[model samples]
Target chain A: MKYKDFNHWELAEDAYFVNWVLRPNKHADKFWKQFLADHPEKSEDVLLAREIVTNIRYSDKPRLNDTEYNDLFERIISTKRSKRPSNVFYVREAQYRWVRYVAAVTLVLASAILYNQYWLSSHPSDEKTIQTLVKESPRGSKLTAVLSDGSKVKLNAGSKITYPKEFSDTLRLIYLTGEAFFEVESDPARPFRVKSDKVNAEVLGTSFNVRAYPDDRKISVAVAEGKVKVTNADQSTVRFEHTLLPFQESEINVQSNQVVKRELQDDMIFAWTNWKLVFKEEPLSLILKKLERWYGVEFELKGAIKTSETYSGSFDNDPLKVVLEVLTSQDAFDYEIQGRKILITSKY
Target chain B: MKVFSESSITSNGELKKTTSSRKLSHQEIVQGLEQGDESVLGYIYHRYVQDMFGFGSQFTRDRELVKDSIHEVFASLIARRQSLEKIRSIKSYLFAAVYHRIIYDIKKNTTFKNKNQKNNYREFNIEFSVQNRLIMEESNREKLNKIKSAIKNIGARQRQAILHYYYDGFVHEEIAMIMGLKNAHSVTKLISRGLKAIRESIAVVVVLFMTDLG
Candidate 1:
């Protein structure tokens, strides 16, 4: 019979007959007896159908035994595990993880060759300290860029730094635009200076952080080890100076050239280096900027609402959509996304 | 027909060429594999390697081609073991892997220069009758052989669905996945259609083979 002669319900009946009735279920027995009573002349066709059903059901097909199946799976998994990288490839932890891996590996390899070249030419390994000079993170980004000097720099969002290919014999100089963390190689002979738009921080063989985003009015420098000189560089002469000790930060107001000192919490300032974004009553507009930078996307809003809303929340490095979705899940907020733009409105 | 003792009816294990390895119980093997044990892998290889090799060999008469393809599946399992999720049922996965490897091998070899390579590949299948001839005799043997020859004349996909469902013993879900159908229901329809086609082919083969005697 043609397939079209049967409807979907009939097809279902055919399935029910083939699978259930032959096996002798209560329903199947009732259906089979009723089927015969209803159409006695077609009993042979039904019996043939039953036989076909049983044949289809009971046919001995080949398959892998348990022991063999397990062994195959085990071997495949073990090999894959062996190939996994040891370090958590946290893309946002240091820089974009995979890119940073390739970039770091390439940079290390390239630098290693260059270091070897330098060593062969100079014939001294210990004389020169190699460091990676990294630029500061942008306004809403936390990133690490290797400096040419082998001094590692971790840039917080809304930060930038510029350093020389090689530090001069007399001085190590770097220009900064925003926030950054620096691990400087010990060289008391050559003092290292980071020049921001308003604040200048000088250090020798120490780790410290500087925040001097151009858009922000404050230039803050926090010292973790040793000491640093925070000075107002915009003045014709050094108008203000603060000698900052460990666990101390100096904030310089760019507009007024005024300076303030505050005792530091190491975890709070260094948190960005560890892939955390901390906020204390931060403006909603500022948080949006950070989200956009973190996810490498752009956000647009109506001008009037951008400056009016303020938010307080902390986040780790996560996908922008995931972060936004989580944020929207909170009470008193409703938001919708159209393509890349997130339209935020308060629920209350 | 060839005669064989009980000893010759060995479990599905490796063969040199020209024969298929026997099918084994798939359920237990799959359960063992999901438990993170390597022993199961070896057992599966031993059990299915011959049958998989036999099925693979039908695509090409060359013994090395079948062996190489079978070996590749094992090697791939080893290399990608970590990535593979612990499977609850391995029958679908194993057959799918073997079938894919066969297709890959066919594509890689430049010698099989032909138009509609996919159609050619689909047309090549290890049918039931030819396979049963080695183990059966008399009227039963004739039925099996006639069925196999009849299967060759059917449309490629229909033949595949029929042979897989009837001979290889794949379920609708497995067959659908292998044939790239959207769901099991589609597979059921396809299979019923295929069986009807096979039945027609069986009628034609019976009439043709029987008429020759007259």
Candidate 2:
């Protein structure tokens, strides 16, 4: 028999032997017991292997007492999230109260929309008709808002999201500009649709980021959790449609109407939502561009703009001055900040 | 109408351990779940919350996040009950669900960066060892240490593969699906290499122990 040539470790690794040890049957039990009895010399190896299979265990698990388990079940069964004035970004709210929510929403959104009158003039939506609320995060500052539907949005600096105060029975739609990370509450019946400048993302339930900064050439949608279906805007006669799973993202070019899908390189894409600045092997020009939105400063580059050199570091929302110091130290450039203007002159 | 197999339900598979014959099988629980019976969610949650918490904590240390992910997994499973007919093993399906959920949570929900943050993301962490009683006995101390040291020498991925296979009662394809490998072929290679490492590490001890036994 093949068992004659097997060592203890091989016997332990063997599936047939492991099955006998883990899930014993009468037939295999009799066969293995007789094998051990007949081959006394191989008994040691067989016993040793059996021990190995039986002994492997992970660390002890976290167990709830009887009370906690019962409470957890009760909590999970109910419509758990009751949206009662949750703080921004830390929103675990349940859905309730349409008029009161719209009141609070109008306070933040009315001023925000009016403040960007020039930007809104292009679309010129007659506010009396549809009744949509818009929130815009000013340059150099992020804003978090919990929608009436209990979905959460973390708007990046210089970004805006126009959403209805109360979603219709059939659909929940929102419009976006610049970039925003959304933690959409899953409601399969009413699909959450985020219509950006030139791209639209439709998701039943998901957490994803949509970047459609007007200045940027490409509109990108990156999924942190769940799935997102991204497509080109109606302006494009040739429709673009693609579904992105977790840790996957899509980029749609404005001019070309091109759609590309790729794996998310790192969680750094989510750093902004967490209030972190994590740069992983990023080019110098791109770094400066992010710094502009982060600090509300414009870079006036003189002598040479070093686009080739790359930088990598993580900062916990460091001040602009300190960040500039660290950045200039790595490259031969001197940056001077004067009234929200950053002047950088490359030495090399 | 297929009854649950022993191997599939081996991970605390029975609802209650009574020979009186009222014990609910895994298949029945799933069937009830598919039939819009919300009560099974309670059984499933109470039955597997501890295991789910334990498995999820391996990926991310946040206790609340793990609990929340567990709730979401069960909640979402109920939300899509119509798709339950195809699931073979509820344990593996729940585990895979929790695994994916916690991982996705880790990607976005991680607010602070501790030193372990670099090492903690997107990895199935596990520890391997011989049984406690065997390690403590006087006669087997040296031999068991040798065996454990060899097991420790296995890589993290290999250790996870082994844990899924032996402890969790997952076949190669299931392990492959859980670990996000391409197929069972890769999982087979990973297990073989891991066993080979342990074998070479403990060959001398096995021989020495065999001689002592003789």
In candidate 2 the C-alpha lDDT for residue A11 amounts to 89
RMSD of each: 26.4, 16.5
Model 1 chain A worst lDDT run, 10 consecutive residues: A102-111
Candidate 2 local lDDT, A167-279, one digit each (tens): 76667777777778776665667887776545567776555566656666556667654456776655542377777755677766555656677887655676666566667
DockQ of the two-chain complex in candidate 2: 0.14
Q: Per-residue lDDT of A146-201 in model 1, one digit per residue for the tens?
A: 55445567776655565556676766777665556665644566776766445567
> Could you give candidate 2's per-residue lDDT for residues B153-204 as a string of tens digits?
6787887787777777787778888788999899888988876776566666
**Interface root-mean-square deviation (Å) of every model:** 24.4, 18.8
Clashes of 1: 37
Output the number of the TM-score-best candidate.
2
Identify the candidate with maximal DockQ: 2
- Number of clashes found in candidate 2: 3
Candidate 2 deviant stretches above 4 angstroms: A1-129, B1-68, B71-214
Q: Pairs clashing in candidate 2?
A: A81-A94, A82-A94, A83-A94
